[model samples]
Every structure is written in structure tokens, then in C-alpha cells.
Target: MPVKYNVTERKNLQDPQAAPKFYASAKADGEVNLKSLSKEIAGGSTTVSDTDVLAVLNDLIKVVSRHLADGKIVKLGDFGNFQVSISSDGAETAAKVTSSLIRNNKINFRPGADLRDMLSTLKYEKYSR
Candidate 1:
């Protein structure tokens, strides 16, 4: 009879492909899209269909607007909070405001406990020469 361990020995495992290269490629694509969007918006010569932009913008507006209207805080898992905070006096001066007006309603999401625990428990192994 032989003793069995739950953890697999490192010597029996295969090496994994590098993940950073994939992440860099994805990030580069996002940057390219942003630059193209900026150029189109600035040039004004290229006509972007209103329906396409409106659909995306409206979806975003609906999420925030609905949550605020319902007086509920919208929580996005792994992201931090969105809530409506009120200010009073209608004065532009920060010192003069005293909780009289519903000045801004925003979304805030605090990361869930499970996500925090998982992040905290992450471990890395170093390869020896």
C-alpha cells in the first residue's frame, strides 16, 4: 500500500502558456477601438448612425436611472458602490451645502466577500533553475 496526497506533485505537471501576452493583445485592441471612436467623433465627417450609439447609451442610462428611481443601491459584483447622495442650499460653494438637495445620484459597487477572500488566498510558485 502507498500513501496518497491530495495535491499533485509539481514534477508531473505540464507548463502553461504565458497569459500576459494574451492580456496585452486584448488591451491593445481596446485602445485601438477607443482611438477610432475618438477620431470619428472629432472628424464629424463620418456619419455614425444615431440608433447604434443611442441603443448603448440608453441601456447605460436605464440601468442607473432605474436604480436611482427605485431608491435602491445597485451593486456590481467585484466592483465598488453606487448611491444617491443629496446636498442642500443650491450653492456652488462646497461649504455652503447642507443636505437639502438630491444633488447627484451615482452607482457604487463594493466587491463581494467571496471575491476578496479568493484574491487574498492566491499563491504563486517560482520555478527553480
Candidate 2:
């Protein structure tokens, strides 16, 4: 199936006098949850149950979360890499920094080679509202 995108006009908030620019935004056809994904993977093998796939997937999530919390970069082979990132206010001096200076924390995912190549291989279709 071809991925769908729509042309959107976005204004530059930083420059009010600038002309609006056009960009291609992906038009989502639908959302697939973990249950649906497990079912799809199980379809190829008649012996594997969806429940088994789901159980393994659940364990994967837990393992990833635990390792990431421990400040370890989790690499899922060709799938991707997951790590933690933090944003904090700058300190006047190295000794002045404290826990209160820390502002935000987030998990960052970097796609592996196979996932990154999908952008060039996938077909696209223009979507109109």
C-alpha cells in the first residue's frame, strides 16, 4: 500500500511578514495497536498463537524499559537504538549544578539502517481532504 501525504500551508511564527510555506505531511490511514501487530506476525505461522507473540512483545517492552533506566543504550539489532536524553538549565559553575536544575527527561529512538532505508523504498500517494 502507498503511504498518503497531504500538502499543508504553515506560517512562520517567528517571521510574521514571511510568506507561508508548503510542506508534505503524512496522512494517517489508521492506527495499529500491539494486539493487531501480534496477530499479523502470528498469521504467517499456523502453530504460533497471537497470545504467545503478545507475551513475548510485553516482555520485550519491560526489558527495554529496565535497561534504559539503568543508563544503558538498548540496541534491537536492525530495529533501532533506544536511549535516554535530558534537558536542564545551564549552571553558572560546575559546582553550582543541582537536581533542581534538571528540567526535562525523554527517551530517544534512532532508527537502524533497515528502518531508515524505508523512506526511499516506500511509495507515496497524494491525499486530498
Candidate 3:
């Protein structure tokens, strides 16, 4: 199946006076939450129940969160890697920068081989709203 995309109008932020430009952005058909995702996983395994999958996924999230907070990168094999990213204020010198200079932290996910391959071969179709 082809991926769905919607046309979007964007501006050049630096040159606000420039004419608007149109681009194609991928649009999700729908989203699956933990419960729905777990059911799908269970469907692929005869021995695993949806409840079992959900429990394991919940624990995985907790463990991953703890590892990230401890400054560790969590790698889920071919699933991807997750790490904490920080945006900080600049300091005149390296010595002048401290934890106080840190602005905010965000989780960054770098997709693994499977997702990269999917992206490489994806076909797109313009979505009609």
C-alpha cells in the first residue's frame, strides 16, 4: 500500500517576505495505542495473550525511561535506539558551562534497519480530505 501525504503551505522563516511554498507531508491514517498494539503483537504469537504483551510493553517503557534518565542509550535491537538529547544555553568558555546552563531534555529515536528499508521503498499517494 502507498503512504498517504497531504499538501502543506510553508514559509521561509528567515525570509518571511518570500512567497509561500507548498510541500508534501506524510499523513497518518490512524494511530494505535498500547492496548491495540499489544493485541496485534499477540495475534502473531499463539502462546502470548494480549494482556501479557501489554504488561511486558508497560515494563519495557519503565525500564527504558530509567535507563535514559541514567544517561544510557537504550537500544531495542532492530527496533531503534533512544537517547536523551539536551538543548542548552551557550557559555563563553567550557568551564563556565554547568548543569544550570542546560535548557531541556528530549528523547531522540534513531530508527533501525527495518524502518530505514521501509522508508527507502515507500510509495506515496496524495490524500484527499
Candidate 4:
């Protein structure tokens, strides 16, 4: 069986009649319901269950919270740093300075060399007239 994935497209907010834009604008400002958003993305009449989406988002939040509590920097592959810092007294001055205040019992994940190399190899395609 082939794997299926969801692809999203960006819509222009400047056009009010642009196939029901996802976000609200001054012309038609209203609350954005998840069901409507899901339906639009699903590209079908099938209704999306809220539980599934909520579960995935909750899991992600839990993972990030756990890592933060452990004083460990959660490094996403090819992404930036997610570490906690604090203010500390500087040696040169008597005033406190903001710096990386890594606490005890922390785990930090430095991106692997392969990940860095892959990120650095990104190239954009040129548009032809």
C-alpha cells in the first residue's frame, strides 16, 4: 500500500472571495473552528474527529514539557535550539547578565553532523520568465 500525506496551500488574504480563506480578515472576521479547517484541508465532505488531532498536539506538548523540566535542550533534527536560560552576575560588572543558565541534571542534544550538512545543502529553484 502507498502512504498518503496531507498537503496544505497558502491562500491570499487580500482577496475576500478566495475560496473561503482559513484566517479571518477585516471584511469577514469570525471565529475559526477546527472542524471547518480540517474539512478544508481534508478536501472532502468527511468530518474530522477532534480527538485524534487533540491527542497528537497533546503528545507533542508533553514531550516538550518533559524535556524542559529535565533542563535538557530539546533539539529537533535540522532545527534551532530549545534550551532555557537565566540571568547571572557577570565577572566584569557587579550587575547581573542574561546568559545560558543551564541547571544541574540537564540533557542537551546537539544536532548531529549529518543533520547540519543536510540543512546546509538546501537550494532554492529559480523562476523563469
Candidate 5:
């Protein structure tokens, strides 16, 4: 199954008056939740059951969260690296900056080589609504 996408028009934020640019927006066929993913894993001739897979996946989430909270980066082998990033308001002086100045906190994911390589050979088809 090829990835599907639809043409979308987006306005350039830097130049609102400029002509809208066209881009390809991913058209999701459906989302595979943990249950579905676990079932797929169990479909293989492996001893691991879906329940055990789910438990491990759940623990992975918890472990990643704890590490990120501790100001540590979590590297999931070739999958990617996860880390916490912050957006803070600029202060006039370095001494005036404080934790309170931090406005937004987010998790950033950087795809690894395998994922990047997959994208380089990605196949897509136009999807109609």
C-alpha cells in the first residue's frame, strides 16, 4: 500500500501577500493504535504474545518520559532520539532569566538513518476525498 497524499494550498507566513504555495499533505487511511500494532506483532510466528508486547511498549513510554523529565535524552537505537525542548521569553539581562520565563515545553524527535533512508524511497499516490 502506497502512502496517499492530497494537494493543499498554504500561505507563506513570512509574506502574507504572496501567492499561496502548493504542498502535498498526507492523507491518512487510518491510524493503527497500540492494540492493532500488538496484534500485528503477534501475527508472526513468535513466542511473544500481544499482551506481553503491550506491556513492554507501555513500559517503554514510561521510561522515556522519566528520562526526558530528568533532563536526559532517550535514544531508541536507530528509531530516533527523544528530548525535551523549551521556548522561553528573552530577558533583558542574563541575571533576570529564570525558570518562570520558560513558556513552552515540547518533546522533539529526530529521525535516525533508517527512517531517513525509508523516506528517500517512499512511494506515494494521489488520494481523492
Candidate 6:
């Protein structure tokens, strides 16, 4: 399926007084929750049930969270790698830098080869209400 997008008008934040520029923004066609996603996975295999997929996925989330808290990068073979990233306030000296200065901590994901390939080959379509 092609990705759907809609036209939008955007103003440059740095120059708000400038004329608005037109752009294409991706619009979500829909969202799939765990149960729905599990069912889809189950359909691709004969041995797996939706419930089993859901249980494993739930456990995956917990396991990933635990590993991340331990300062480890979690790499899912063909999916992606997740790691914690942070920005911090400038420190006057190396010795003065500490965790307290850390801000805007976030998890960052770098797409794996399979995902990168899929993204590279994606097709798009303009969406209308």
C-alpha cells in the first residue's frame, strides 16, 4: 500500500513574516494496537496464534525497557536498534558535569537494513477528505 499524504501550508519559524510555503505532509491511514497487530502477525504463520504473538510482543517491550535502563543498546536483528540519547546544559568544567545537567533524554532508533530498504522503495499518494 502507498503512503498517504495531504497538502499543507507552513510558515518558517525563524521568519514568521515570510510567505507560507506549501508542503506535503504524511497523514496516518490508521493505527494498529497490539491485539490487531498480533492478529496480522499470526496470519503470516501457521504455528503462531494471535495470543501467543501478543504475549511475546508484550514481553519484548518489558525486556527492551529493562535493557535500556541498564544502559545497553537493544538491537532487534532485522527491525532496528534502540538507544538512549540526551542533551545537557553546558558545564563550566569536565569535573562539574553530572547527570543533573542532562535534559531532553530520549530513545532513538536507527532503522535496520530491512526497514531501510522498505522505506527506500515506498510509494506515496495524495490524500483527500
Whose lDDT is greatest here? 3
Candidate closest to the true structure, highest TM-score: 3
Q: lDDT per residue, candidate 4, 1-129, as tens digits?
A: 122233335567798668753432222224666655554545643564555555555686699888887777787666545676544444655344334432333334456678678758754332222
TM-score of 1: 0.28
lDDT of each: 0.52, 0.95, 0.96, 0.54, 0.93, 0.96
Q: List the candidate numbers ranked by lDDT, top first.
A: 3, 6, 2, 5, 4, 1
User: Is candidate 2 or 6 superior in TM-score?
Assistant: 6
Candidate 2 per-residue C-alpha lDDT over 42-95 given as tens digits, one digit per residue, 9 for 90 to 100: 998899999999999999999999999999999999999999998899998999
Q: What lDDT tens digits, residue by residue, belong to model 3 across residues 8-46? A: 999999999999999999999887899999999999999
Taking the tens digit of each residue's C-alpha lDDT, what string does model 5 give over 1-129? 889999999999999999999999989998999877877888783899999888888899999999999999999989999999999999999999999999999999999999989999989999976
Clashing pairs in 5: none
User: How well does each candidate superpose onto the true structure, as a TM-score?
Assistant: 0.28, 0.90, 0.93, 0.33, 0.90, 0.92
Model 2 off-target regions past 4 Å? none
Worst 10 residues of 6 by lDDT: 97-106
Ten contiguous residues minimizing lDDT sum, candidate 3? 23-32
Please provide, for model 1 over 1-129, each residue's C-alpha lDDT reduced to its tens digit, 9 standing for 90 to 100: 122223222332354553322111111111334445545554674566545555555686688778877877767655545676554347777787665555554455466778778668755433222
Q: What pairs collide in candidate 1?
A: 79-109, 80-109, 81-108, 81-109, 82-107, 82-108, 87-101, 88-99, 88-100
Off by over 4 Å in 3: none
TM-score for candidate 2 = 0.90
Q: Cα miss at 92, model 6 (Å)?
A: 1.7
How big is the positional error of residue 67 in model 5, measured in Å on the Cα after superposition?
0.9
How many Å off is the CA of 48 in candidate 1? 19
* lDDT of the structure predicted as candidate 2: 0.95
